[model samples]
Target: MTDRIRRLGMTAARFALSGALLWLLLSQTDASALMARAAAIDPRWLAAAFALTVVQVVLISWRWAVIMAGLDASIGTMRALRINLAAFFLGQALPTSIAGDAWRVLKIRSLGFGIGTGVRGVLIDRTTAMIGLVLVVLVTAPLLLARMPDPAMRWSVAAGLGLGAALLALALSADRLSGRWASGRLSGVAEFGRAVRGLLSRPVTAIPIVGVSVMVHLLAGATMWLIAGSLGLPVGLVDCLVLMPPIVLVAGMPLSIAGWGLREGAVVAVFALVGVPMDGALLMSVLLGLLLLLVSLPGGLVLAFPEPGPGQAAPRRIR
Candidate 1:
């Protein structure tokens, strides 16, 4: 009971912080202008953005499937898609972003897989995706440095790439050392480590997962480009490619609900560096958030009628 109360308190605190930050951002901007811009956005561009979002979902789900295959738990592409969408929706709608991942862990466990296997798969998938994000930023650092003349922005880009490289190196080294420690004093730790290493050892498997992650981000960037176009913002695809990765990485942090305030703030700051208007950037980010919410609505249906797994009985009540 005490633990449950603590969890509730923490959840409430996070929601409050998310609401506060969102309100603060909106208060500082011209709400009327943002609304007008949104109102004027081209429907066709929104349609394009939605299509790109669908593609992003499919690619990401495929990546998840690949990760599961690495674990020898190979699920079908369609099933992966369903689970991904449902998890995404829950992640956004729940009090915390990790709620979706928890749902995923539960789903996997329900399928008679060990909790460790489920966790390992999720961790590897997340790690590969992060590595892909960093790679995107590193790969585009040169173009960004040349195009954007802001010294501060250049330094920021340099720092981000350096951090990304360090993280990748650390992950690789940890995977290598995990096997050595598996039979050591910390058997549990070593076991988890071995699991991570096992999933990541094969380049033939890991490379494609990373590639899919990169493709998903690219599609996401393109979706942003379409949103910018809808808002009549002067941002280009190259600008989106250069800026979106870091913005996304930051926004994905568990700091705010569904990345509401953090995403808007990041988009506004990055677009400013490239000379795009603040209002337009904020609007574009908001639109992207809305489209995501729309796409995730189907997840509600999935939740309502969750399919029973093997050796399990159907729920008598959904509410």
Candidate 2:
């Protein structure tokens, strides 16, 4: 009972913080202007953005299936899609960024998969996707720097790219280091390491997953581009490619509810570097968030009517 109360308290705190930040941002902007901009969005651009979002989800689901296969837990693509969408919906709708991932882990475990396998699959999938986002940011770092007139912002972006690169290297090396340690306290770490190594050892499986991750991010950038276009913001695809990754990385942080205030703030700051109007950028970001929420609504149906159990349709053996 105490634990339950503590959990509830933490949840309430998170919601309060998210609400505070969102209110703060909205208060600073012209609410009337923001709504007018939103009202003026071109339906065709929004349609394209929506279409790209669907493609992004499907591709990401396939990537998850690939990772599961690599880990010797073979889930079908269709099932993976359902689970992914459900998780996505939960993640967005819930107060925490990890709500959907936690749901995915539990759902997979319920399918008769081991807890370790379920946890490892989700962790590795997220790790690889983060690496991909970092790579996107790094690859376009020079372009981003060139666009920034302020030395401080340029240096900040460069430092972030360096940190991202260093973290990626560390993640890649962690698996190898885990093999040398045998402490029981580190057993979980060892298990994750082995899983990482197992996935990377098979490039045939690993490369495609990473490749798809890059594509997913690129598609995400495209979606943002369309959103910007809808808002009549003078932003280009390259700008979105450079800006979206960092905004995404920041928003993925566990601070705000579904990245509401954090994403808007980041978008406003990043777009300012390129001379885009803050109000328009904030509006575009809000639209993108709403579109994602709309796209994830199908997951509610999956949650209501879950797929059959493993006994009904046995999981395929990992090849």
lDDT of 2 by residue, 140-244 (tens): 888878988989988987887888788667655654564544456665665666677678678898788879989988999999999999888888898898888
TM of each candidate vs. truth: 0.89, 0.91
- For model 1, residues 1-319, the per-residue Cα lDDT tens digits are 9999998888887778778877877878887888888789999999999999988888888888888887888877887888888999998898788888888778888888888778877877787788788778778878767766878877877887797788666655553564544456645555555655666678877777878888888888899999999888888898888878878987898877898888888888877877877778888888999999999998889898888799778768768
The candidate maximizing lDDT is 2
Model 1 local distance difference test score: 0.81
For each candidate in the order shown, give its overall lDDT on alpha carbons.
Answer: 0.81, 0.84
lDDT of 2 at 227: 91
Q: List the residue pairs that clash in candidate 2.
A: none
The CA-based lDDT of model 2 is what? 0.84
Model 1 lDDT at residue 58: 85
